[model samples]
Target chain A: MSALLELSSVTRRFGGLRAVSDVTLSVPQGEVLGLIGPNGAGKTTLVNVITGVHPASAGKVRFAGEDITRVRPYQAARRGIARTFQIVQPFPGMTVLENVAAAAMFAGGLSYGQRARDEALQHLRFVGLAEVANSNAAALTLAMRKRLEFAKGLAMRPKLLLLDEVNAGLNAAEVDQALELIRAIAARGVTVLIIEHLMKVVLSLCSRIAVLHHGELIAAGAPQAIIEDPRVIQAYLGKRYARAQAGAHG
Target chain B: MKRDASIALVLFALVALLPLSGEAYWMRLGTTMLMYGVLAMSWNFIGGMAGYPSFAVAAFFGLGAYAGAVAQKFGVPMGFAWVGAGLLALVFAALLGVALLRLRGHYFAIASLVVAEVLRELVNSMTGLTGGGMGLNLPIPAMASVDAQARFFFYVMLLLAAVTFTAMLITANSKLGFGLRCIQQNESAADMLGVDTTFYKVSAFMLSGVFVGVAGAVYASWVYYIEPPDVFDVLYSVKAIVMVLLGGAGSMFGPLVGAAAFLSLEELVWRNYLEVHTGVLGLMIVLLVLFLPKGLISLSQRLGRRGKLR
Candidate 1:
């Protein structure tokens, strides 16, 4: 399949420091690409540039073959690009149903109230949050809040979804559940670019993995190959991987 | 259908009986209450729903009063003067919103307050049109007797209040209302969900200004006097904020309850204390904010729960 999103030579800066520098990445249609890195790898900065939350100092972003470098966040959303924040910002005062319904009505083009409600309910059910639909978003547990975040992005019906650390604070079982959900999301023909630190989730869900370190990509390949790459081992896996590699090489 | 019928019935009952009841003083007081209820409700549109506390109400209200006074000076009909004032206020609202809405949260509030002060000073300096600090006086309508004019103005104010209140109620449940609420909750998230935050904010600001302007027009006509200090009082804006806060900032019925409670307190305090009435009003606001940060309506709602945690 053709690439769904292409970031060519993207760079972002905050005063003197460059957050993301000359980064080029691509996610093909209906593919789950994992972006793994140690802290401060510019993974979240890349997401910000892609979603137009922050303008890139230098780069071109093409979505579905159209140059969308200067598009605003809302315009990018309308063009089938939606994202969740690492912090999981939901409308605190609104009911979970109202939160998703707002996304459905505004971004999904559901004019009728009943249709919006139905679509919102469908999204809630998809995220396993249907039972708590009437509850205030502020009342949700962290895992539920993450799910609501996903449901909110899903309500926009975007073709390209950016998931930012959706499994950060979950327990082991919750992590597995989230992994299943992420896989299901990709299985629905939606392309996903996930920024995560958990190797288990990345290894299990991603078709291809990209390792970033100190604002640069160290490796990009199939999951098994990326885990075994020399640079990836040096930058992330460290001494144990070095010893294993030495034993194999010798 | 049933709810609509009940609402219509309540409105009809209020309209048919309120003017006929009791003494002239009560009637005048009732008119004042409605006028303030209108102002409070209008403020809630921007401050409560859109989560932007604007302090430039005096600017819009003063502009409307001045517009009416100018129109009346040019021999415009009384009804046309009100319309002209509303349009002028709408224009002022759009201009002021463009400049002030760019400042978020507390900065927006302070910018609006500064703008109102600037407007007050400018109006005071303009000797030719606004009559400077001494203020302007309009000619009395020779066609109507004093009592007839008072009753007419009361009904006009009542009608304007009803229109404004109903419009707020309708819009609060509409798509625009949802968008405003979303903008308040999370501006960036709302933007990502396809809400035009700037447009919604400006529209709310303009809508609030239109009602406030209408109130000012009626106020000018009722008193048959227009003074810079009276029309441009910063207290008017404070009263709007106090009423909305007391009533329930975001609730539909909050402004009405707030206005009633506030005006009644003012009347009682003025009758009893006279000298320290303003201080008493200030104290009441402080106490209310201390006890119930969410407002009187929410306080009552919580009271029924018998201290159950929210």
Candidate 2:
């Protein structure tokens, strides 16, 4: 009914450099909000703050109506916030099933053994990785590895998932599959605040797109409106795209 | 599963009947093997499964030996003395693990190494309680023959090895093992996934201390004396690490295989090249690091995979 995640003027600073400034944002329950930004735009830092990987230097993070500003990362996971690393944190030597199972055990504490294995298998199947369940996680192709990372996040059964570039490095067909999986996830009542780069995917899947540039949110509106914002075009989208838009409009 | 159970039974029968030849030398060797097995297996819990390269084995072992020795002198039965030693080591581990487990990789390894060496110094300096470097003696059973005493200690060591091995097997299958493996792979990821990494690591440390400390106590009584230099020797810690690394650090049978390989290698070197035993062993360890970096277990696993391929 309310926002699943609320970042009120959230700021993350590394020394004097604010990676993410006082950027207030919220993702309503069951909505798929897209975050678009250029390099060093603090999309990852914002996700880090929400996932409790980095403590907010200022402001508050209210999730599910509870303030979780200072909660530890693991504690945040326990309270149903999950994330996929942009760089794909590989659990070397673990089987794909075991990787998912580790998340299931941590997220659900599924009394271990068979029940946990079953749950992990289910997640692997959902991520289209059931065939390579027993294969070492490192053995997966880059595309499958991305899916594995996403599946691991899904295994947590979080109310809100912070997917960082899940579609990155994916082929056209793979991206389509990923989009379908994300839509299915939202249908299952899980809220998604995705930091995606593919504008096509963002425009197609997201109900609203938020533009961040230089650690600040410059524009937030429907996908169509966000692409039209002059500030968004100036910072993120090149001047060429703005000129093309102006020429097409004239 | 049935085949595995039968194999375990055969292994059990082999160990239980082993030393029936009445040879005192073999009995002594068996005792040493089982004792080291217990130590290595204990280390495997923290080092192998938990992925913490702990160098505190000798500290716990020496502490256990002294605790048991003190209790024995105070008129406590030797059996209860071992239990007291285990409990003392457990408490020490619980406290030490909390602080030391924070250090990772080489920092953790060095810090743990220092704990044992520091304890050795304290034991050497504290003459009133631990007899300083002079050592403590155990009251030998007056009527017992050397053969009978050897057999008695051999069985005691076997019991200890069996207990530690069983515990290792149990942990290797539990959520603790899963959590440990996760931690071993990635501590931050494990924590992010909601694993209580600190709790598991510290628990593994304490588990290691309990068995190793108890084994040390039994060893003290069996040997009839324990000097701080001998019981708290860094060589003991090195041997345990070598054994675990040689066999397969994390698996249930790794330490057993390693202890056997290490002790056998020691015997071969000591008997055949007494003048250069340590040098030869050091060279062998170097070769082992270069070649069998994953230890002998990886070889076995490779062979098993080959068999599956067939």
Candidate 3:
């Protein structure tokens, strides 16, 4: 399949620091690409660059063959790139249905009426949040809020959905449910680039995993190959563990 | 939504009967009440809906007053001049919003606060056009009797308030309103959700300015004079914010309720404590904020909940 999103040597800088630098990556159509990194390795920054929250200071971003390097956040949404914040961002006073309805109405291009509500309800139901659809989003538990984010992302009608540490702060069972939801979303053919710290979740869900170390792409391959890569291992587990693994392998 | 619209219509009709009471003092009070209603509701579009604490109401109001007064000096009919003033404020707000709205929260408020001062200076400098702070006079609307003139201006303000109310109702139910609510809640999230936050904010700012602009124009015409200090008084902006806060910021009836309550309090305090009315008004606002932080609408809502519980 053709690449749905292509980044060529993308770099984002803040003052004297480079948060994301010289990362060339392509997410092919319908692939759930895992973006794994250590703390401050710029996983979230890369996502921000893709979504035009912080447009790349250098290089290009192409979505579906159109260069969107300089598009604003709203334009990026309209162009079908939706992202879930690592910390779930919901309109606190708004009901869950209204929160999702905003996504359907704006990014999904649905009219602001019963149709938008109906669409929001469907996504809520899909995420098992239909029961709390009328409750204020701020009142939701963390697990429910994560599910709400999924519903919102889905309501955006995104061709490429970026999930930022979606499984963070969830228990094992909650992570499994979230994993199942991601699997179902992938089954529906939406390409996903998920930032994850959970190696198990990344290994099980991603067709290909890319590793970031200090704002650079260190490895990009199948999950199994990525796990065995010394560089990837070093990036995550430190040089000591990587050296031990190399010694054992030899 | 239909019920709210109808209730608003009924309330407006009841207010329209003020001139029939035959009390000139009450009629004048009613006119001022309606003008306050227009300002409060206009502020609600940005301050209440979009959650932008804009203190630029005086800027728009003063601009409109001047625009209308100047147009009248050049022989423009009063009705068209009022509309021209509204359009001018709308365009000014759109342009201002693009730049001013880039700052959020306290920064945005501070930025908006300076706009009226800037406009005041500009008007003061344009001595040839604005009469160099000497103030400008409008043609006295021709009528057979003084009572007829009072009724006419009162009705005009009442109509302007009604139009503003209708616009608020329409906005409250529109996509623009929903987007604005989203922006108010989480602006960055709203942006990611494709709400076109900048456009929504600018639109809200324009909505907040337009009716106030027209009201200012009407006020100028009603009073037959306009001066920088009188028209560009920062108190107008403060009063609009206070009224919206007093009413319940986002609800449809909140601003109107707040305006009525505030005007009544102002009138009562002025009559009884003429020497220290401003102090009394400040104390009352403090008490209201302490007790009814959500405004008067929440009082009804709380009571309804209590009644259901019983």
Fnat: each model in turn: 0.76, 0.76, 0.98
Regions of model 2 farther than 4 Å from truth: A245-250, B1-6, B141-143, B304-309
Residue pairs whose backbone atoms clash in candidate 3: none
lDDT of 1 at B304: 77
Candidate with best DockQ: 3
How big is the positional error of residue B250 in model 3, measured in Å on the Cα after superposition?
Answer: 1.0
lDDT of 1 by residue, B15-105 (tens): 5466676467977898898888888988998998999998877877888888888788889997899888998888888888888888899
DockQ of 2: 0.75
Check candidate 2 and list the clashing pairs: none
- lDDT per residue, candidate 1, A105-213, as tens digits? 7877776367898999999999999999999999999999999988988999999999999898999999988888888888899999999888778878999998888
What is the C-alpha DockQ of each candidate? 0.72, 0.75, 0.92
Q: Candidate 1, which CAPRI tier? A: medium
The digit string of per-residue lDDT tens for model 3 on B58-139 reads 9999999999999999999999999999999999999999999999999999999999999898888898998868989899
Report the C-alpha lDDT of model 2 over A86-120, residue by residue, as the tens digit. Answer: 87886988999999988888876576788888999
Q: A84-124 in candidate 3: lDDT tens per residue?
A: 99999999999999999999999999987999999999999
Model 1 CA deviation exceeding 4 Å by range: A241-250, B1-12, B299-310
- Better model by DockQ, 1 or 3? 3
Candidate number with the higher TM-score (1 or 3): 3
Kindly list the per-residue Cα lDDT of model 2 for residues B1-310, writing each as its tens digit. 3453466557766977877887777777888998999999999999999899998999999999999998898999989999999999999999999999999999999999988888889988989987888899998856468777787788888888888877877788889988999999999988888888789999999999999899889989988899988888887788889999998878777788899889999999999999999999889977986798888878988888888944
